[model samples]
Target: MVVILGGSLAAACAAPGSGNAQPTAAASSAPALSSAPTCGTEPVTMKGYFETGFPIAKALTDEFTKQHPNVTFDIREDQFAVITQNAPRVLADDPPDLMRLPQVSELVKNNLLKNLDEYAKVFGWDKWPPSQLQQMRMAPGGAVRGEGSLYAMGLNFSMTGVFYNKKLAAQIGMTTPPATLADLDAAMAKAKEAGLAPIAQFNGGATGGLAFPLQDLMASYGPAAPINDWIFQKPGATIDTPTNLQATQHLEKWIKAGYFWKDVNAVDYATMMSRFMKGDGLFMFNGDWESGNLDKQMPGDVGFFLMPPVQAGGKQAAMSAPLTFGVGANAKNADCAATFLDWVATDTQARTIGVQIGGSHPMGPADAPMPPIAPGTVTESTLAAGAKIAEDNGSMDFIANATGAIYAKSWTPNLQKLVGGEQTPEGLLKSVQADYVSQVKGG
Candidate 1:
């Protein structure tokens, strides 16, 4: 049974049912093949619009083409903000077979995305762990999330945490993951004193990445239920609470202490990752989606840990949710598109690609076999961290996902101001809460 929080949603790994048995195969053994039907041998070209700076989708599509040579992909890429703004127009005017999704409530309310429940049954997706798809379900008209018809699916389930450079960590005499928030601060201070960037974060562009760490801090300071309530648009939900204020103040302190890059307001996501990989910073607040890339670029130089809780031995939390994707309401190749999505979780090769290249756990039945991950790589660490989150029941959806425009409009500018010393922690929460209210009321 899924553990409900805030009377609305479940933790990322918690879902609505039990008795779903796991596959008994070991990691090294070939996965049991699904009996589901494929998209057939018809010649088809799937149109796709994907988020930029992630190669996992492209890699998956390429492999799918290799297996089903008659089906090819015509894909386009854009930054997250661009995709968020363009999703409506593009989905209504010229729809793609599949597209990376952001804040899906508005789209569902607009009837711009296909209802995927039928596809779910066709592909046996209903048999998978329900929590894996819970976030994607919504009521008709998008008034509520976490319950209703399924509309989207994840390429993989991802979790966010602190990823550190092992060499830089050693320089700070940090050999193990920080045990608490204070310990993490001490380590960051040491890195700063050692002439290293403490936190290599991206707060620039319309999609401010600072929300990543801020939300993680919120979880570290308090329970994740309120945050999820706000994101899911539960009645009477608000982000400007005492606990969140404390979380925001903590982030503000980090900003004022020079832990973050001096020019963080000008650095975009790609630039942040590039800088972090170049060993310019001791740690980065990011998701497991980058695990494969970091393992490839840094080898064993990187390590991962959850956002340490405020007190020692306290439960840990992070923004853990699916890397969501959906079919357009008017998609020409809807059946094939869905077949591809189901293949992502059920096919052995596709699951391996998701783990090795996507750096995320494939979304499927509880018993699905995970591809082998080398013992010391960041990917392995992140996967282990995901399991820890499951045990602690401390997973959250990204706070920027609270509303369709919340990230680009409220969080980004407000955070940019916080970085520039123009916004107070109190004011930041107030401004964002106001924007969230306005958007939710369709003002």
Candidate 2:
């Protein structure tokens, strides 16, 4: 009855999760949102590639077409693992008109994307928030703040939180979602003792489901030095320190205890979610964006709780990387594409996609009145304003973004071993650090 990872839908009409408050109050005078794009007469065919099979991606395609009736659109969807893994090959062969990428600066550093700062100005881009502009800065070797010329625009962002079932919790004698790290540990133990699979994770998406958050927690409790060092390029950085040791040590405890799915890292996306949606796994952790997808998958039984802090101040924080983080530098229809991505910020696009699919808005509240999976389910936005949260909570960049994603790509195998108790966290950390350092030195 138990297998992979999962969660619920955001009911917020405007907010990201349960639709609460705007992260940054825009100056109410930003043109009341664009009057929806209207360019049917001069339609241009644009090819766009992004993460695979979701309502938002499809909604984006539909909404863009609605305003630009004449434009023939070519949309490509795939997993981040595949596309980023084959970034060079994809760019060289088809050279799509536009691409959805992470860390636009990386593209600029590699000279793969075109700079859109000037064009952004002509498009009245300043009306957009500063927090949004940070993605496009033109700084070099910026391991921190993702500095580089603005070559990308994130459609919206999602954060990590706990997804649980209240009904099931009560059945298992565990009440609400666990709030503290120790609470989490206790809840997992209870679920297992009750013969219910407690924490469900898809190991195949290890880079996201595991590696990304584990490292973020490492930054939360231990030295901000290693994480901060990546951004500021601190000297003599080492992951083999106490910070990583502590993070990995805690993780091993859970791994050994059957808190997460065995061979979780080995599970594929389809199987993982399929089992999860069936209520097989008691809790799952992921971005609020999954609200829509999870709603479709599991309906009424799903709910989200902020990522519990590892320590006292660590509660309700997120471990996240923005979705749809890029635009093609040499995009033939750069102007149109840039404007479209930017509009996604204020427009009803994210909400609409989430609404139809039962998701959380990337930046807005999840108060939208939508059909529920069960008679009584929480339909709230799971997303908070990405920019604001990053600043207030201290954001950490994934190693993949640094060192050109080599570690992100290689992490799954090692993590699978770690979670399975085949590799010690210390051992895994040492090898990864050594390999990363060698690569960085060569540069």
Candidate 3:
């Protein structure tokens, strides 16, 4: 995903391009909003914020520089929060040649993003189906609308699921993993009976420790149903609804039952990750991005599965969204940055980099006749099985960054309140609904 600090989209439903056919906007003759080519001209300087740390940008810069020897990649790294605060300021002073944004909603709400609707067509976004606008928190048109343009070319997609220790499961005499909420309950109960910590969560980190779990809850209904009506749109959904109520009470039951480690709340990202990798907790909820680190974290084998739906045969919502890249709205050598972004978005080399490094690209390294993972790592089958679980569920649009934080902030406090026995699900729902209604609608 690409965003120029400025330049812009609106009005009229441009038909969703037929099939995965890439669309070309009518930008051949028009001046590029934020940049132009840098192959032979002034040095193109581009800046970006990387998610998995500086190594990602370092890797991409190395690869990108190899092609455009004249282009200089000026990349920075920060926690997603720092980047969020920095974006508007950067746009206010000078937007970099590029920025890697985590959520689709940022480009939308801040108006710092530049639209790529034209770039999509020129770059064949349809051919790169995963490169389309990230739909995490926004509605269909929200990305282009909020950012004043379609400012990102998304890459590196992942789905939501749970990871667990197979060794731990076997120790409890459970052969099959959980396939439903009941199964999960049984697993939790057994883990408790066997004197295991049972489950793990890095709630103190992000997603209020509920990002993937919330997606799991929503998955039971179908990909779009929960997000479109309940979580995303908030269509005045009531806690009184059986499904909502079930979702509300279900996880809390485990928490109260001593299914979770007591220290989970005290452990943030670093500590939690260390424990997950080193400890004997039975289950973890996270994306595959954690797999490599997890391989190192666990003294025993680490694997994953999709938590089953509450309702049998219910649709599973696969959480996949764009780790969107964008053109800086205020790029100095705008053309060069645009070219670099285009190269990253379209070139096979750039795509392959992501594939190799466990970054987001169409193919996973393990997808082939099977690429080699590190030694002492989990089997490709284990990872693929988890991926297939997410795939089977239908990829739900990821919850965009902006709304994501809202949920994390709101959801966690409310969930803590409910689980700690300070509030009921209905009260929690009303509290959250009021907050969303007030903040989202400015009502």
Candidate 4:
């Protein structure tokens, strides 16, 4: 999982037990309670390992236990980078019933993740839109994705865009969401001129938070297909392209103009969000995962919009992908875990939790009724932006998810260098492409 910054999906590799250890509530290994696994009316404690900083999973688990008193969750939480580094060993040695998964190709290759094909049949997930599950499929040996056996499921489909401080925007005379890249730049310039941080971004720690805005810039300058192809690991795919370079240069311009905080490279995701919420920044490049949080913390003060394209009326695009989780291949409660995954999508209460708590589009059949959102809340705006992205067919997976180690090893460092003036925009893309090529070749 490449950490998506605010709601990261970045992955890293480390020796077993090398990263900070999470507190395990249960013993490392739990015995299988039943040979024939089913979500039976028996006492069950589902062990889950979830990413920290997001309340949706915990909220959903609490609701699930409310509905199924016989079932309960014993969940552990950790940062996304720690989870990425520790995933392999955890899956191999003391697998949880369900866990937040990073990129699944490598895990599927190692058989660490359970194939959910049978669960799809039992839960009628096969009847859902094919595109809903497309990103979770992987070929044999995990050499390719977007096709093959299903290995994971999402709590909800999340999308990324620009989240703004409405009060600050009004101060800068930004009455409406920017309609183009030039418009967006002008808004940022106004914010900066007003002595406000234009973009409160997180580029520090183990995730390259700048990747969020950079990727959005990529979509604005060109089509999302090439970016998706690169992330999906199509043969001969490359990230160092002309359009992307133009995008990179634009981001460099933002940095040069002091749109971001001077110490942005030192601020972690939590700090960035905290500052943004406190009105320290006028804009934030983030995902819908923060919509619910913002709605609660700031109420109607925040607004969201898809990253506008280079020109007004140009097709819009966004980094839209699933908030993926998977059952461990050797889980002691596979049946209950699969049941939980299915419930997240189809159960009315669970789907509502996904929308109101997860701040993402619920993954289910196309006709599934959406939970109502307050007309002017950030969640409503984000969901509306998601609809526009869907209508334009401009969804893309995060660039950090191109490979398991690429986020931590390549993008984060190169992007950090770009921020520090140690790497030029062209050099940043070239260096990342080199690392990507090596990783693709299993270096």
Each model's lDDT comes to 0.86, 0.58, 0.56, 0.87
Q: Model 1, residue 9: displacement in angstroms?
A: 49
Rank by lDDT (best first): 4, 1, 2, 3
Q: What's model 4's lDDT at 258?
A: 98
Across 110-182, the per-residue lDDT of candidate 2 in tens digits comes to 5555555554555555555444354345564433344444555555554555678665688777766555677
lDDT of 4 by residue, 1-443 (tens): 33455353233444544554432423222233433245789899999999998888999999999999999899999988789889988997898998998888777767778777777776788898776787898876678788777889999999899999999999989899999899999999988888999999999988889999999999999999889889988889999999999999999999999999999899999899889988999889999888888999999899999999887899999988998998887788888998888888989999998998788999998899888878999889888887788778898889999899888889999999999999999999999999989998983
Model 4 lDDT, full chain set: 0.87
Model 1, residue 336: what's the lDDT? 86
lDDT of 3 at 200: 74
- Pick by lDDT: which candidate is best? 4
Candidate 4 positional error at 372, Å? 2.0
Best by TM-score: 4
CA shift of 164, model 1, Å: 0.9
Report the Cα lDDT for candidate 2.
0.58
Better of 2 and 4 by TM-score: 4
**Cα distance off (Å), candidate 1, residue 327:** 1.5
Top-down TM-score ranking: 4, 1, 3, 2
* Model 1 lDDT-worst window of ten: 22-31
